[model samples]
Target: MKLAKRINSSSVFLVSGGARGVTSECVITLAQQYQCKFILLGRSPIIKIEPEYVKNYFDEYGLKKSIMEYQLSQAQKPTPISVQKIFNQISASREIKNTLSRLRQAGGSAEYFNIDVTDYVSLQAKVTHFSAITGIIHGAGNLADKLIEKKTEQDFEIVYAAKVQGLENLLSCVNIAQLQHIVLFSSTSGFYGNIGQTDYAMANEILNKSAHLIQQKYPNCHVVAINWGPWESGMVTPELKKAFTERNIGIIPVEVGTQMLVKELNSSKATPQVLVTSPVFPPATEFNLELKTYRIRRQLILDENPFLQDHIIAGKPVLPATCAMSWIINTCENIYSGYRLFSCKNFKVLKGIIFDETFVDEYILDIQEKAKDNNIQEVEVFARISSEKSQKVRYHFSGEFKFLREIPSAPLYTLPEEQKDTIPPWKDNNFYQNWVGMLFHGVSFQGMNKFITFSQEKFTAECFWQKIEAKQQGQFPVQWFNPYALDVSTHPLGIWLQHFYQKSALPASFERYEQFAPIPCNEDFYVTTEIKSESDFSTVADFVIFNSQGKVSARLFEVTFIRWFT
Candidate 1:
């Protein structure tokens, strides 16, 4: 197969076992993330999404508004009548007119191919026509009682042949011009072997091991395996699904699983593999497991409202001032926006605040291109205004609310910190869109970071910023490196020594501390000074942060194992 000399927009991709469950999610994900031609491989070219299936998903997500937006009509479902309507439309002479019109308006490009992975000849022939493929996501599976029930003799043969044969066939195609990645779907059963699924277990074992084999053979191509655990899908019966995951949440909510899978796939780690999620989860940050050199006194974002000001100021400086809370917050906002729009199936966002080992380089690479294209030095996004004196930007579409880009009609108001006068977007409603602007105090940290003069300046914002960015010339901020993996309680002083230039902090700024108000406890404060276990942080530790004036700043926090109720 031939891929373009370089994999870019002209590349092609395949997702076998798409149109169902996690596989479909992969297809949707790659389609949006990469501009490439897509071929969806499934058992049948005709995706007969049944009404009952649609209804089942709607029932699962029982919110009325969600139901209205996501669920399809009975007519749209792949029922006999629905199928007949689709067929008629395809060949409509008014009789088959509907399908013709539908075909004309399918929006994006998609072609379906029916091929059984077990049928080796058919699989090879299917991919041969394409010169090369940039990527292949093998999410298809015969997860029938995957590990739940004993397998028949046939089950062993069928499961193994499908994944092994299909994968080997693709790899055997030596002439493939360029294949950057080959992602295999290995269930969690592979690692935590399943009792009942002897045959399916073998198939997963093959998938589980295939990544290593591919890496060995083709160093240029990244062979990634995703070990997915229990997920909500047709493969999972309701009772079994519940047993497989934590209570109160649906089986590994499809979106979370999908998001986790994509992140794992994009990672360049050696033989990169990721266990998508866990069955049980902890609620808060517990960072007593660290280098113990420091402790947080307090930490909080500057606020326009005085009450709000004191709200977050109860922790240590878990995040350095050099840390980009704005960037982190904006990343979450972008994630939220994508999920809200188009109900993009695979575009999943985790429900609550939890920081796991996330692969951020992939995300940066994807967004970096956009930033470069837009020449976006720094973008000041005004999300919410909590005060009247804060910057409130408005576009010229107030009269026509719900206008293009869904930009708001009125500026959100908030108090301006740094004490600048809040500028009104526009005093006149009839003003031009360009004329109506919001006050956003933004500075680009992308560059202009090399010269840091710390020899003699007061503790002004500029001085603080220069000290913060002393080491940030070629490198991104420490916060941007991997916020998820950060052990918060370790950085006790917020005194970044690498970036910490001359002692400008009143001669002995590091020499003193006095406890303000000690809350009488069961004498049960689980405290830690530093982290020694870098290897263990990923499996545990929600996050760890040093506090400022003892204010909380990180989602990853500091509580020992005992403080947790469970």
Candidate 2:
């Protein structure tokens, strides 16, 4: 989908905390690029005149000394706190003036208002006067860094209200239809929890989730929450920089960070939540521990996962077999800190999960480490899941996962020869509608775009990998293996069975599946299924998925399915 143009000379932006710090740097960059109008909101009042005593002293040391000396001349005690307050006020005023001056030099007009975003009445009144606001950037936030045990109620309020409440007030006052873009500046601390930023993390997570909800409500507006790491400028002090260096965490440069913001604003992609951090921040896992078994339990309900409604079979919702494999792979990958799934061996669906009269509510997944080779950075894990209703331990699904430090390259695939003249060509929509009472999948599960070729022994089809949102994925979001795309890849085999034997089938097991890389959404790829063996009650086939360039993305070997007599 195409997005509207972001900004122009006539576009007016309402920016919170835009007078100074990182937000100020972004405003300056935007002015230089687009020459747009900006309305800056801050807590610092615009001071046109400087005091005579501190006017001549521009340096910090000189200014502090001058303020102390002037206080003594007035017969008042110059405490350290009082002197520091005056010094801060002077510095803030200068920063604001410098920002306005730089914007003017860059061919942009700006106006600053001394309004505390936390106060809804004051923020609403100020926002009402401006009716041309086409965009909003929520960059206002406060830091009260303290350990959770030592944190106070006031500290939480100060830090939380600045981000959560500030955005709420802005959204409450602005005209929702007029806005073209909305950007929320979040922190990586929220994405990955931090030690002393409990309150800050909680506040920023709200922003991240809010972006998703807002984008769903207003499809016309581009809303995004960027979870940013520490930058070279802004809140990173020299002492903190030293700490980050010691931990091998890289800091983002000011120029690079601002440019990323500009790119996000102009991009057409509709990802509402993004995490931008240094690659080194999440350190690699060191596997030197003993083998262990981990058990995790989850409650599964059909109502909670709305996508299952689309996967109805015989008027009953049933979990797709590919989704079961996804759970196994995702569970294994998340066990280690930095490991990724290389392949799955011997994946079996012992019993299908159908939401019939007797529905299973809870399931337990057990992952046991079977083998590890530290020299090659590879580990083998066995995973299985069982339901609570069964008296005996009956596993519904099971698989063996092989994880490696990095994914290996996939071999090139040779396209199979097609007998196009033998079988009549079927349109995309017609195939889905007239397929022999076998295809019961709804829109979300139907990914087969068109049939390239079809025969009794083998077939090739083009599948459209549409993007599935988090809410549609049922239990979890799309991680390593996209269940929808992988599920659709098996449609060719199903069609072959229905056309020849006049029967329906469901996937029962697979000998192996090797994944070279993740399949991207909003793209088209080809899946070719070739029959290996066939019997009265079962069929075995091999599936290969490749791009237009003939590079294989994934391969499934010895895929066996149980045929049902119709």
In order, how many clashes per candidate? 60, 0
User: What TM-score, over all chains together, does every model reach?
Assistant: 0.41, 0.75
lDDT of 2 by residue, 430-520 (tens): 5567884567777777777766777777788878878867787868567778888888888767677777888888889999999887765
Q: Which ten residues in a row have the lowest lDDT in candidate 2?
A: 277-286
Q: Over all chains combined, what TM-score does candidate 1 have? A: 0.41
- In Å, residue 35's CA in model 2 sits off its true spot by 3.1
For candidate 2, give the lDDT of residue 237.
65
What TM-score does candidate 2 reach? 0.75
Estimate the overall C-alpha local distance difference test score of candidate 1: 0.38
